[model samples]
Target: MRLWLNRIGDISLREQLITQIIVGILCHELTPGQRLPSTRDLSRRFGIHANTASAAYRQLESEGWVELRHGSGVFVRTSRPNAPLSPEMAVDQMLGDIATKARKLGVSDAFLKARMRRWLALEPPARWLVIEPDPELLRIVICEMEQAVTLPVVGCGFEECSTSVMLEGSMPATLPSKVLAVRKLLPTGTELVTLQVHPVAPELQAYLQRYMPEHSTDLLGIASRWGDFQRIAQTMLIAAGFAPESLLVRDATKPGWKRGLDTTTAVLCDAAIQHDLPAGTRAIVFRLFDEASIKDLRSHEENLTTPDRN
Candidate 1:
């Protein structure tokens, strides 16, 4: 039986092995009484430590998916197990397969981890843990989510969510672009939610209609510490027929990024860095969550908070 191992991501190497073995049994890829590769062989084949391979086999045996025969090797259980495998078992199998393929294609461990994290985080979060690489962007997401949902919301950098205190029974959330990186740090079974930003065209058009005249040459400024946010904002503005040259983009994480914005017609920024804009600057603040995102958040929150009647 082929066992796919993912070296990076929030799921540990041992958990990945155990999950894959169980999946193999459930799918009949590993049949009853089928002997599995020895611990040393498994370690050599998968580039893992011998102890990790041994621990994986032991876990499978403990979980009743396999049996260990002294002086022999591990074998798939011949009899039916007491409990049925969950749908998530199939998901685990798919993840393993993807990891294996990704490794073969010369993908970087960091890139694979990011991809896995994003896919894993597609599940809705219980409570919101806003993930942003930038401190300013993190605070903005938390604030926006708080206003949109009744559930508790907090903010942190991508690295901060790895702590046990931050992850326990909490849902980690972030902008769509950062989902992969944040997901890589979360433990298995942790739910991740992606917050969608409202498209800028409709809102920007409305603002222009209300504040500026036809064919006006007013410069529009977009500011954010997050590169994704800046890019998305720029794309939306250009797509809405705003000339690229008329838009001033600023990366607030860099020093002296605040200068020259006062000359623009209006500065558009994420809520977090709005305070840092030049005094008396006319600001069009963009929100992180759209109406659909709010609805999804409400549904997830309700599912978590509402007890099962059954």
Candidate 2:
């Protein structure tokens, strides 16, 4: 539906699912005592691998967020702090948006083929990261996303020594199992792309390319509405193996505040610029990384740098 998932930060699909269910239960979108879809059904519904769906359920159980009966199905057991009770409203609005997009396609056969081709050509990703210039509150959400996606993230810190943690090449020899997701940062002002993530959607790709700005990592030039961005980010995480942590949102909105307030209500840094800008003005500097597309320019043996120790 109109996913309340924040598109910013590096989250995995598992994290987003957990957030959705938790928020769903807390906000009454998913009623308490109602049975959840089996992990198989849920996986199909969410386009997730079944095993991953099962893991998410287990995580929810561990969190005391839901209860699993022998065969009765999973049930909501708790409400998260300040969770919205507007599930119905959110769903309605989300469906409306989906309808609008579908209608825009207008059943064009040729247009549909191109869209399908794009989807088919895309590869499954393994990692993602979101580095907000104002790193405080965003860090919390990033941490949650790492947990949700079950993938290690980078650039969460201003420190450079942790560079090895990135899926980047540590050596120039050997073959790696996969290419590392790398953020190609330029040294010059606007030439630099500060945020090392993927763009929300291809639909906004043209829009993003138009923006000329200076940064440490690339920023999404798409300029989509905040709500749309939230969805895109959620989708990326889900695809990359992370999920958003909606339950962690802290309502930082304040009346009469200007410039830095993020209207999305996600726990954003106090310097988010939403509170500082002119009304209707917003800035989104995030995208997800599809590690599969990376090239191993280094020795594969030492390429991963920090291989999964466990």
Candidate 3:
């Protein structure tokens, strides 16, 4: 990830660097375990003083957004606290407080240590549980997730998210719109990954501009297993000035859905149902997950599959 520094802006260079790097990590542009540029390199590239760059990196490390190892340089941290804490001093304080509390509660130090180790050794996520209210949308998201990551993908509605069977050994993920609600339903300490939806309007607009000139009445077909997907595409095309009568919509869940598609100019469909389109039909697939979201899922999958030697 490239950092853009505003040398002339009201914010100090150190503050600008810190803010941009934090934004990159939060947006998944700079992923967990990814190495950050050295302070020297950042200084040279941005024409900032070495101390300014170093201060920004030190602040990031202190805030737990990154880890600065002695020889390994700085890496983006995997865990984020619900509240900010100084990485070294605050962590030491936290552990000491825990020990003090345990002693006051009549807990043995050895037993406390053993329980802490067990919590640290708890199993990583074994699969993904996609939480969405719409069954059809859930299925589409699961299909996209399965293709993007190695982990097994399953799904349930928001109400079912609280069920033990649905969440056990599974990482809970949901669309951005449902993130807050899903977070409330998950167990405490369970992190919810927000799935980013792909924006379809730009692609659709570009295609129309390139192929279908304005006022040209070519039959455009939209096919998808999800009825909402078909309806959305139909609406977008119509909103772009394509007459409603010039569009053919097909729901792949129904019979004879592909029969009339081959005769149309082109078919726009969801990625899950694109293969089911008629053999001769020209297909444009609208994917559910954006590339960055897919990359984040794959990163989580990698952590699950790769064992920790330490």
Candidate 4:
């Protein structure tokens, strides 16, 4: 129940409710083996329309916050802070009780001041980061604070994300979801390339926590070698009633293709145009990988560019 409320942040009312649920779970107040309150219960508790409450719950479920069994209500996912923080996190929770008690008993100002002074005297935290579901999610989300193109990035072997920390989660690039991308960064005198994607996709987030032992959102870029996902996304758009005329193909070498072996990406886009791209289509370009792994079918491009000796 409280699990869904914790993810909301600076969004609409819908976002707040969702974040609250997530926060509730992360604080360990919602624990692993807990069942969520029904949608109806949440609606009545927060005075929201049932549909809105249902949407919030559904969104969280989609993000792997909670699960819904056929005959069972949603359950708190133990898998993903993306797990609760240490039990010691509860120490701060006592403040609420102390405040309540202080109000009830009218504690002396001197006593409260002494306690405040003691609290301020404590050492600063060793590390400070929002409790992430897993370490990978934590690492990736941290870096995504700036949507800068990664430099010498490595995936940390995070194949799937466990949580949706914006840019890092298994976010749908095609879907109208929030995602971050880094533009190339190069100084006039310095040639060092720098770019990074932060936060992680939900699938990658979960996987990183299970394997990698790192903390930083400085994610290595998802390999765009073959533009595999790009081709797939273009195809999907074509199939979904979006005309090729509306499609924007982007990639490494559209102009350089006439002379040699073409990249699979370019070939795929060209193929889509012949079969699917309407005349005068608008296609986006991708510039990460060079021709082969990127542009189109190299073999066919060779044939087209090969000198006919006949």
- lDDT of every model, 2 decimals: 0.73, 0.43, 0.77, 0.39
Can you write out model 2's per-residue Cα lDDT over 1-310, one digit (the tens) per residue? 2232233456666777777676455435576667777888866665668887789889999987789887777777744566565989888886577556766868555665576579445443234444333344344334434433444444343333235454232111111111122222311111112222222323223332442231213212212224434454445333332223321222323454432333432222212333444455444434232232122111221323445455
Per-model RMSD to reference: 21.0, 23.3, 13.5, 23.1
In candidate 2, stretches whose alpha carbon ends up further than 4 angstroms from where it belongs are 1-10, 78-274, 278-310
Candidate 4 wrongly placed segments (more than 4 Å):
1-11, 79-310
The 10 consecutive residues of candidate 2 with the worst lDDT sum are 170-179
Q: Score every model by TM-score.
A: 0.48, 0.30, 0.63, 0.26
Candidate 4 has its poorest 10 consecutive residues by lDDT at: 171-180
Per-residue lDDT over 30-147 for candidate 3, one digit per residue giving the tens place of the 0 to 100 score: 8999999988888788788999988999999998899998987989987655786778978899899989988999999999999999977888888888899988888788888878
Writing each residue's lDDT as its tens digit, candidate 1 over 1-310 gives: 4444544333466766776576456445688999999988878877889999898888888867889999999899897666865889977987788778888999988999998789646544456777777776677778777777886888778667889878765777777668778778887656677776653334544775564332336688999887766865665444334556778999998998988899898988887788899998988887666677778878877886776577
Q: Model 4: per-residue lDDT, tens digit, 29-143?
A: 5768588877788777756678887787789889977777667787877664445655667676666667677768888768887987895565422221222333433333333
TM-score for candidate 2, residues paired by index: 0.30
- Model 1 residue runs over 4 Å out of place are 1-127, 132-137, 157-160, 174-184, 207-215, 235-245, 254-258
Q: What clash pairs does model 3 have?
A: none
